[model samples]
Target: MRTVAGAPVRAGLPTPVVTYALMAINVAVFLITALQAQSVMDNGRGFVNPLSGAAVFDSDLFGRWVLSPLDVADGDWMRVLGSGFLHFGLVHLAVNMFALYILGRDTELVLGRSRYVCVYLISLLGGSASVMAFENGGFTAGASGAIFGIMGAQAVILLKLRRSPAPVIGVIAINVIISVTVPGISLFGHMGGLVAGAAAAAALLYAPQWLGAGQDRAKAVRIGWIGLAVVAIVTLGLIAVRAAQLRSEYGL
Candidate 1:
């Protein structure tokens, strides 16, 4: 692809192809679901609206998984992760996918593919967990939470390198402003993802290491693994707490 400002794009950078693919998937899923919504409503067949606040925890596609909004309030717990993958409208999906493209490519370049994926998933989950914590009865759907997490990760990495984080901080601040000024945006989810991303990035990029002078490269790898572990534990803890809450509510 062509780079902006007439510069050639480097071929060796971590391209974030997976990130792009994820965006595509989210868009596609939203489109298909939207169409489905239209079809059902148009048919007037007395079909219950899946988008209804009541359908969330209902079993679907083999009754094995709970969906969002409904499950979020019903305390299905799993919906915290599942909800991140759903979107309410075209603009919602587009904004998130764009953010992912812009921030994800650079994060992948800095952290490599595996670590990049780890950060994204953790951030996504973190955002969802935040939503569950703060909002209990609304139908919330979007990728902003995960995208914020990625931004947080980028900021953490830049800070560790002693690079100026002014630009990034500015971007984050602007986004936060937009989120708050605009109606229907989940400020809680976005802030949650941002905090989670920062924590994960700090563990990954700045934890103390014990490598000798000649073993800097190896030390970096070790630190990354440790950071990943920390992030995983924290993320799982959040999910578990949400799950427990759900179970208690449902008496399951």
Candidate 2:
């Protein structure tokens, strides 16, 4: 892919290709889930429990629903990351993918594919962690948190490069405002992801030069890994606490 300037986009850089690829993956996953749902219903199966709560781990959709980090502790750990790609409805999916398309492609082009992917994944984990931290006993699904993290990383990059961040900042502000006004949004997840993105970007794009010639790159990797760890820890902690509570309350 080439930038609008007609310059050949370098290999290994963040590009529209990667952005679209991720979007396609997300969409494909959603389609598969929907199809599975159809098959289950056709076979006389029904989702008896609906997930409630904004926390990703604490939320459960019936006893069988398994798309939360808390489920991981119970041997359903896959949901820790899987939940980021799932969505509750078309509008939810569309909004996130659109945001990812617009911000992710451009950001990837600037940061290179490696850094871009790191930022995105870290942001996603951060969002999930935040949801687990604050809200319990509710099912939450969507990519808004991760997408917001991208926006946050972009803003940090602009600031680090000493470029005007007005455009990006304005966009982020608008989205945040909308999230507040809109009902059924996960404020905790979005905010957490945004903060994590900013922190990761700062560590990667800023930081003392004496750290090393490859210090920035190293920092980015560390940030991503650490962010994931933080999310996982908080999610598991919430599950343990909730489980204990349940045992006490219901004598389970």
Candidate 3:
């Protein structure tokens, strides 16, 4: 059956627990960032109405939590993880969370919890890594990268299941269009997330078969872990090299 989330959910699939949890986590982090921003903006009090366009930024809070390629080079690599949970404004937070609620549900169901989590992390970090490697320094924050990653993974699932991949591709195309037409979207971040998600999903699904990880379930499991470990290392190494290049070229 066709679905907007890229594939149909089966009749008896358990609730998408991981999906719900991720949405909750994103919302929670946004709350923290919002409070921090409010304190920064309003004489150390509560949040401002972003809808009123009166919100002020806390550069210190943003720099600490948002992903900055330069900050990453200086050993604040944790920002890569934190940035996915941060957002520029309430509208940004709302849009990303909504998208996550939609895509994460079907994705977690199809990929299962463990692989779903891995794909999300890979996509998120991949986007940060790309931002670190290519973009100029700024406070880049949002879960769109992870969301794009889910979209890519979902497309892969539909293709594997012999379903048309057009809907996902179309969604991606529309997103790219919007990103280009609108201001402030991270293009490379989205691209990196989508590619990484697709790669991670393919690795998870096919590594066992490719490695001939046959009847020995234990052996197959080990191989899968090993493959992911190798990919993680490679990802870090590439990011380091690119980041170094950026620093050296710009003298930053």
Query: In terms of lDDT, which candidate is strongest?
Result: 3
In candidate 1, what are the lDDT values of residues 221-248, reduced to their tens digit? 6766777788878876876777667658
lDDT of each residue in 1-252, candidate 3, tens digit only: 423222245677579888788888877776676676564123112234579733235434554667767667766778878888777666777788889988998788777677688889888888887787678655578899889989998887887778999999999999999978888789989988888888777666567668997766666666666666665666677678876776787676
How much does candidate 3 score in TM-score? 0.83
In terms of TM-score, the best-performing candidate is 3
> 1 or 2, which is superior by lDDT?
1
How would you encode candidate 2's per-residue C-alpha lDDT over 68-88 as one tens digit per residue?
A: 434544555555467788776
> What's the lDDT of the predicted structure labeled candidate 1?
0.66
Give the TM-scores of the predictions, in the order they appear.
Answer: 0.78, 0.71, 0.83
Clash count for candidate 3 is: 0
Sort by lDDT, top down from the best = 3, 1, 2
Choose 1 or 2, whichever is better by TM-score. Answer: 1
